[model samples]
Target: MAALLAAALAVTGCTAAEPGAAPRAEDARPTVISVTDGDVDLAILGEVYARVLTSGGYDVQLEIHSAQDPVSSADRLLAGEADFIVGCTGELLADFNPAGAEEIIDQWPELEEEGVGGFVVYDELIASLPSRLSATDPSSATSCDDAAEEQGLTQQVVPIFGATLFDREQREALTGITRLITTADLEDMEEAAEETGSVVEAVDEWVLDNEARSGGAFEDDREDVSYLYTP
Candidate 1:
C-alpha cells in the first residue's frame, strides 16, 4: 500500500506549494492533505476527492497508510500530519466505539438490497465522534446492510476531517462529491483501470467524462495528475 501510494503521488506530483510563496486570490486556500487507509477502493475514493478539491482551487495531497498500524490515518489527523480522510461510517464508528457499533448493527437485521440512504448508526456515529473531528453527510451509494455482510458494519463512504480544515464553501464542495459519485461509478473506475492498464489514466479519464456528463461544477486537469501510465 505504501509503495502504491508513493507511485500515485509520484505520478500526480502532488506536492505542497513552496514556503513564503505569494498566493493568488483565486488560489489562496490553505493546502489540504487527504489521507486514506490501505484499501484500494478507499484510496481511489480519496483520490477522487483530492482531485475535486484541487479543481475547486485548493492545493491537495493524498497519502495512504496501513489501517492497523500505530501510525494510521486517524493518528495522522490527530497528530496534525493530515487534514481529512475518506472513511466508511460503520467501520470508522466501530474503530472508535465497538460496543456502540455492534448495538447499532444488531438493530437492523434485514438489510435492503437496493441503493438506500444513510444508515441508522450515522447520526449516532457523528454524535459519538471526538469534538476535534467532523464527518460530512453520508453517501447513499452504499447502505449499512451491504457493508455489514462484507465488512461487518455499515460502510457508507464519507469524508471525516479536522473540524476546521475547510470553510463553508470548501465543505459544500466536498459534500457535492459524495452526492455525485455512486457505487456503479466506483466499479466503472476499477474496470477502466483494468482496461486501460494505467490506474492514473483511467481515473483521469473517468473524472473528465463524468464532469462533462453531470455538468459538474468542478473542472479536472490532466496535467495536475502525475500518473499517466502504469509503472
Candidate 2:
C-alpha cells in the first residue's frame, strides 16, 4: 500500500501538462463534465468520478463553481455549462415545494432544513457528525413536521449524487459502482489526502484497492490523461 501510495503520488502529484501537451481533438469533442464545489468529501467524490471517466477514455474537465450553489450548479447542468456536480452543505438545497425530493434517513431535526430532501445518491453512510455519506442514503426528509416523526437521527446525513453524468456512456459505465464505504474507509482516504496534500494521490491508492468491487471503474485505457482535484 505504501509503495502504491508513493507511486501514485509521483505520477499524479506536482505535475501539470507541459505546454501544448495535447495532441488536439480531431474527431468529435471529448465529453466535458463540470463537477463543482470544493468541499473535502464532495471534491473527493468528484476526483473519484473523474478518475473513472478518464479510465474509460473520455476527456474530462473539472471546474469549481464560481457561484458554488446547487441551484446554480444544477442550472448549469441543464444549461450545458456544467456536466457533473458534487454538491455539499450550503451548495445543496432541500426543497420544500412540490412535495418531492429524496428522503434523508437517520437525519437530525436541526439539520433537516439544511440538506437536499428526497433521494440519497451514494452508498456511503453519513456519519453521526456528517463526515461520511454515500449514494444510497436518502437525501433527507422534506418537512420538519414529518422529520420529527420519522427521523431517528443522532447524526445528520449528507446528500450523495447519482450518476447525473451528461454522457450516456459514462453514466452507463458507472452503474452499480457504489460499494459500502465505512466511516473508517472514508477517513483513511481523507487523512491520506490531507497528509500527502494530494487528493489525486489518495484517490489513486483507493481506486487500486477497490477497483474490482467497482468493476474496473478505475482502469485507464487512456494513458495520456490525468485529472487533479482539491477538497
Candidate 3:
C-alpha cells in the first residue's frame, strides 16, 4: 500500500517541458511566482498562470518549493527577489499578516472568499461490527471482519483532501496511506457505504446521494484501482 501511494505521488508530482525558461530581453518586466513543491496539480497550474501572464505582456518567472518551508519564498517576494507567491490561502494569510504584504490580485476568488474542502475515505466494516465489539474488554473475539459480515456490508471507498477537513493532521496522515475508507462525519460514512463500487463516478452523483444531507463529504478521485481496490 505504501508503495502504491508513493507511486501515486510520483505520478501526481509536477513536470514541465522546460525548467525556468526566461523571456527575451525585450519582453515586459518579469513577474516571478513561487508554488508549493510536490503538488503536481498546483505546479502545472502555476506554470499555466506564468505563461498566461507572459503572453499578456508581462515576463514571468515561476518557482516550485515545499510549503513546509515557505518563509524563504515569501521573503523573496517581500525583498523583490520574486514578485508573487502562489500557495494555499493559509500561507497567504500568514505572510500577509506578519510581513504586511498587500495582495495585488487574487486569481482564485473561490479560495480567497469561500475556502476549499477535503476528501475522506474509511473502511466500511468499522461501522458494521457487533455492538459487543465496542465493549471495553479486549478479551472478546469481535473484530472489524466480524462486523463486516454481521451487517452484510460491502467495502466502500471514501475520498478526502486537505482543504476540506478541519483537522490538518488527519488530512496529512491520509495522504500517506494507500487506503483510507472512512469519513469524519457519520452521515457521510453511511452515504459512502451505500455507494459501494461506484465511488469514482461524477461529483453530481455524490452531491445528490450524499452531500445534500451529509453536509459535503470528500469527492472521489480514484482513477486507478490497483492501489486500493481488492476484489
Query: lDDT value for candidate 1?
Result: 0.59
* CA-lDDT, candidates in order: 0.59, 0.42, 0.31
TM-score of candidate 3 on Cα atoms, chains taken together? 0.29
TM-score order of candidates, top first: 1, 2, 3
TM-score of each: 0.71, 0.51, 0.29
Best by lDDT: 1
Which tens-of-lDDT digit does each residue in 1-231 have in candidate 1? 222221222212223223354432323333444444445567677677766656544456566555455665656666666667677787677766778877766665544333222456677778877886777788866533444576565577788876655544445555666767787777777787668765566677767777654335445543453321111
lDDT-based ranking, best first? 1, 2, 3
lDDT of 3 at 165: 13
Worst 10 residues of 1 by lDDT: 4-13
Off by over 4 Å in 1: 1-37, 67-70, 110-118, 143-147, 213-216, 222-231
Q: RMSD for each model, in Å, please? A: 8.9, 11.8, 21.6
